[model samples]
Target: MMLRPFSKSGSFYKGNLHGHSSNSDGKFSVSEVIDAYKKRGYDFTCISDHLWIDNRFCAETVTDASKYNTHNFIAINSAELHTRGKKYDKENLWHLVANGLSKDFKPSNDEENIQDLIKRAKGDGAFISIAHPEWYSLTFDEAIMLKDCHSVEIYNHASTVKCNRGSGIYIADFLLNENVKTLLTSTDDSHSLEEDAYGGWVFVKTKELNEKKILKSLIKGDYYSSTGVVIYEVKLEKRLLKLKFSSSNNIMVSGAGHTNISSHGYNLTNAELDLENFDSPFFRITISNQFGKYAWTNPYWFNELDLD
Candidate 1:
């Protein structure tokens, strides 16, 4: 059986699932952001401006950049939602990114917690992600509380270059170890404050380049997050896993605590691993090139694929 992303049928659409604009604290306006992303060769982009009450860095309304949609490039309505009651945040706020949201999505008041916020966003037809967990120091308790969300922000480029804590690898693995069944995401979270835009993104597969279809594909784990590497395909048969991709210095399979298998070579474009006795309920793949760019696949469980 082919792993999903590969199992799904569609053209791959390159996109940034998280970003900011002048509607929030970002430097550029919606149109400027659109022009910038299109110039970078993105098929679609989300203007996920901050949706909170803090006027200094947030707006109460979601950003709707749909007017800039053309025959090829388009914008998805989105917001970087926030709420209160967290252990380690400086502002005690939880950062959640919601893509394909309706413009009327409400802002969180002081009383709303993360769970309530997630439920409301999902009910409103949005794909939600736990944003920048490593950058914000989200606690294990906080991650558990949000175990039901669609995905974890596994990589955030803005936080990486700006603060050096752009990876949520631990939290994502921890959630999987806990059997949370969550997906993974990579985002720029760009404010255009520095050289942050286009540094990270997700390549989603869908038949149409519209918001509804993209959101549906995202929720189904029909995409791969990347810093630079591109994965062509993934397939499994008779306990052997095969992957095709661009040149990479390292390719590895990561699983439950301390369980990892790897193969390394120069300009290696393909590799296969025998998982016949690999000791883990779930597995994920990682590829990194010489320039330090990485690509990650969402965890797939053995039982879910009827292989366990």
Candidate 2:
């Protein structure tokens, strides 16, 4: 069988899984955020504004962009959920992104913790994720604690452009190293209408353009995250992993604790790597385009994939 997104039978929907609007710290309003993404050829965008009961960097309610759903493009209900008790955060908040949330979802009260918030979000069937670990210096202990999350923001656009610290690769690697079994995601996390808006997104392999379908797909890891590069296909045939992607300067296979193999050249379109000799229990692909853009594949586990 095929691996995840490539294995799934569906159309690829281009969407930004994390973003902000004036409902929180973002510069644009909900309607404008939708319009901005739509004008830039996006199939969907989330208004995942900061949701917390505070005056500095959060709103009391999740920003609802559901009204902007057109037949072709759509919006998923989401928020950059926050709670207290984190180390090294200026605001002492733990940022989590909960997608496919209802309008009735409540923000964290003074008494509850991150686990409390995650429990509620999971109870509602929401897709939970750790947000921007690098930006806020999320530690290994904290990541292990948020084990309930489905994913971590492998890339945060605003965090990178603003402070030059937008990577969660270290946190993600730490999780994988611990056998946490989490997926990877990339987000714009756009709080402004500037270069932060279109920098990162996901191509979800969903059957239709419906919000529920998209969110379900995400939970199943039926997607690939990117920052401009594209993965056309990934398939395994007799222990040889084949990848078809956009023109790139490098195609690398990386795994647990620095195990990696790479191919580099000018505008290389595809690669055939032997996995039989690959030693890691899991492996992921990363492609770097000539312009320095990167696309990431969710890590694939060997035993779980049932390679026969």
Clashes of each: 0, 0
The count of residue-pair clashes in candidate 1 stands at 0
Give the lDDT of residue 72 in candidate 1: 94
Every model's TM-score = 0.98, 0.98
Give per-residue CA lDDT, model 1, range 263-286, as digits (tens).
999999999998887899999999
Measured by lDDT, the strongest candidate is 1
Instruction: At residue 31, give the lDDT of candidate 1.
Output: 96
For model 2, the local distance difference test gives 0.90
- Note the residue pairs that clash in candidate 1: none
Q: Scored by CA lDDT, what does every candidate get?
A: 0.92, 0.90
RMSD (Å) of each candidate, 1 decimal: 1.1, 1.0
